[model samples]
Target: MRVALLTEGGYPYLTGEARLWCDRLVRGLEQHEFDVYALSRSERQEARGRVGLPPNVTGVRTAPLWTTDDRTLHGAGPRGGRGRGARRRFLACLAELAEVVCRGTGPGPDSSDPDDMADRFRNALHGLAELARAEGGLVGALRSEAAVRTLERACRAPGAPAAVRAARVPDLLAAAGLMERALRPLSLDWYGDGALGSADLCHATAGGPAALPGLLAQHFAGVPLLVTEYGVRLRAHYLAAGEAGLGAPARALLASFHGRLAAEVYREAALITPGNTHVRRWQERCGAERAKLRTVHPGMAADRFAEIGERGYDGRADASGTLLWVGRVEPAKDLVSLLHAFAEVRAAEPGARLRIVGTAAEGREAEEYLTRCRALAARLFPGPDPADGAHDDGAVSFEEIGGPGVPDLADAYAAGAVVVLSSVVEGFPISLVEAMFCGRATVSTDVGAVVEVIGGTGLVVPPRDPGALAEACVALLRDPARRERLGAAARARALELFTVEQNVAAFRGIYLEIVSHCPVRRDALDEAGEPVPFAHPAEAHVPGRWAASASTAEAAATPSWAGRETDGRDRLKGAAV
Candidate 1:
């Protein structure tokens, strides 16, 4: 099967969400051909270059979402002056979309009738997509003053949401710019016959912008779409909106747009795969059907941690009392709570030590958070000031995973007795899984997929509760036998459900299942435009070499059943038997 793998800011890229798993999936499924359609988040990511793709990846087409260059946008005016008719059509679709975004109440009693609102939103969104396809691109018009004015008119309309109605001229302009960027997928040339149109299936690595191309592929052609969301995109948008510093109106409008888009994508997809049940709930609440939802855990490489796992619980004398926290250092990780919790652990067990191992996430905010964490650690421990050397052998030490002390991830896990996750917000707790692979006992706050991933193998505490976190850690630290038991169980669980082999196998099965049910209906043709006989043989679906003999030039041109009265029907029946 030929699969079109759609992604945003990931896969093939050196960095971005889901890049590693996507690479693993593509490389593992060597039987299928993959054509990647990537939407880059920034010029920096594009400039950094892509990871070396496997031979199975037949082609890659990328478009940037960070900026709209003239060449990418194409013609200046709507339809290059196809006349007032085209402009009117564009205005009509934009107005419908703006109105839905301004007033649509998503999946709740807040709206008078949510189903009606959803239908309107879906119709308006598709209308715009159709227009963009017909007009070559919507970039020129979406950036025009007309689009801004239409949005302003919708905001001023009666029954508009309070936040949207509060939008001023500047806010409207910002909202218009955001919409243009988000809808840039509609202007892509990927929907052509040789691109997504030819794929047996369209697999979107995530929803939101990543799935937009797949949605269009389904719209323009009859391609089936498979959506996978590790971190719910709509949820991310809501969380980041506050940090974006946008006005109330713009945030509300964008939120509505994303919600509607997610609903539509869920409605259109043949299958929706959420990384865990936690994400599955989010999708269900946002209108995904229970029948269509499937839980596919993110795959991790277990071989890297095999050495540590095989070593068993040797009870390292120096590291026995050490507690380790491994993940990106961001405010969301809530290092403050972890530090506070460790202070209590120290009070209870004077010999206990804490090791924070991970680099801070990109941006000034993450750097500030890491700095604050170090200060708090120094104050709590009352040892050598972390400002001088944070990595010193203090009660609380912060070190990067790849540094001299910790040569790699496995070493970091090996350096500690209990793994700690203090995130107030998380998605699929990857570090927890990594710790499991290394056969280390974990104490994680109950957030996101932690409980689901842990499956009672690790201690769980409520988020932001330092006392509870400390108690859990102390309990595990004081009882080595219990820690050893949990560690063994965790490793067993991780090996069974969370390895790269399992993930690849699950997707390989899903690919065949989807195509078997919704096979692409295009007919194969010869150079003279004549229909080819037995181009897609029934024997091809069978799990054997029955169709292999047809590979010869004469057999390929004229199937063996060509001379028979019943033709391919008899052969298809024979293969079924």
Candidate 2:
């Protein structure tokens, strides 16, 4: 079977979130062929290029979402792009989409009923799809200054929100710019018969713009779509809205657009696969059918962790009652809270020590956050001889990846009986899984997929509650056998459920199942004017059973002698007649 893997802003990108998982899926399942249709979010990402690909991947097609100028589909008097008449059709589609979006905000026929809103969204979607085909694409037109002015007029029209009405010319330009990037998929050529239409299945690695191509493929080709969401893309939009980088009105509009798009994707998909139950819940909340949802944990290579876990606890838990925190140092990690909790842990148990070891990624802001965490640590636990491997106040210690005191990640977990994750936000906590793999008991905040990943294997505390975090740490610190038991269970669970082999096996079955229900058509009609069947038993294809090898070349090859003999027989029959 052949599959079209659709992705936006990731997958082929060398270092993005979904790249590794997609690479693994394609390489692990060598029985089927794959065609990757990727949508890039930025020039830099496209410049970074793709990950190493497996041979089974037959083709890779890409379109840039970075800027409209990169696309050339919108010019009038085009040399066979699209007729100038197509502009009216494009504008009509845009008007229909804007109307639907406006209604979806609160006043549509289905505003009160989610089912009704779904129907409305579908209608507008089909309209946009028709425009995509009729107009060649929206890229050229969307990039035009005229289009931005048109959108500005709509936003400032009567009944527009107070914030939207206040949007100036620059705001309209920014909004149009954002929309051009978001709707870049409308200009893609991936919807036709030789493209996504020829694939047995369309698997989108995530939602939002990445899944838009898959949506179009299904809309035009009768292809079944499978959406695998490791992180809830819509939720990320909402979170990013809080960071103050984007204008409030732009954030509002964009979030609504993404939310509606997700709802549509979920409603149309044949199946929704979430990397964990946490994401599954988000899908469910966004109108995904319960029957259509399946939870598939993200796979990790566990062989290294297996060796460490097999070694068991390196020493008695009671003797080395240290707390370990490992991951990139960022504001979300809540290192300050971790430090406060560590102070409480020290107060409760003098033997308790906290070791934080990880480098800050993402730039100067991360560096500043790390500095704040260190300063907080020093103030809480001050010491005159800070050089002597002792905390300034004998409570908390901070180090980097290869520092003499911290060494490596696995050793950091080994240094403590308890592994802690204090992040206020997360998608999936690889650190918790890593600690589990090292057979170290965990105390983690309930964020993202923490509860689901932990699955009762470790203690989960609420985020930002230093007291609860401290209590969980102190509880585990006091009980060595309980810690060992939890650690053992965690290791067993991670090995059984989260290994690369298991994830691959789950998707291999899913691919077959999806294709078994919805197969792609590659053959044209036969001379009989009937649809040609693709696969059949060899014996069934023969007259008096002339079965050949299952090779296409052998099936189509006819011997010269056989042809000559048939012609002579036909001539003899004609003469007799």
Best by the TM-score measure: 1
Give a tens-digit lDDT track for model 1, residues 207-232. Answer: 89889888877766668899999998
What are the per-residue Cα lDDT tens digits for candidate 2 across 1-577? 7889888778777856788778888989999899988877777886777787889999888776655553232322212235544555455545545544544433223334666656555655555455555444555566566566666665666776554556566656665667667777766656766677778789999988878878777766567789999998989877765674667556555666677889989987888999988898899878899998989998887776666788878665448787888888999899888888888988899878777777646668897887787677778877643224443345566667777765666667666788999999999888888888888889999999999889989999899999999999999988889988999999998888788899999999887666555432345456897876664223233332212221332223222111111111100000000
Question: Clash number for every model?
Answer: 0, 5
Q: After superposition, how far is residue 341 of candidate 2 from its true place, in Å?
A: 1.1
Best by lDDT: 1
Cα lDDT, model 2, residue 86: 50
Candidate 2 TM-score, C-alpha based:
0.82
**Per-prediction TM-score to the true structure, in the order listed:** 0.90, 0.82
Which parts of model 2 have CA positions greater than 4 angstroms off?
47-49, 71-84, 106-120, 133-136, 153-166, 316-318, 384-408, 524-577
State model 2's lDDT: 0.72
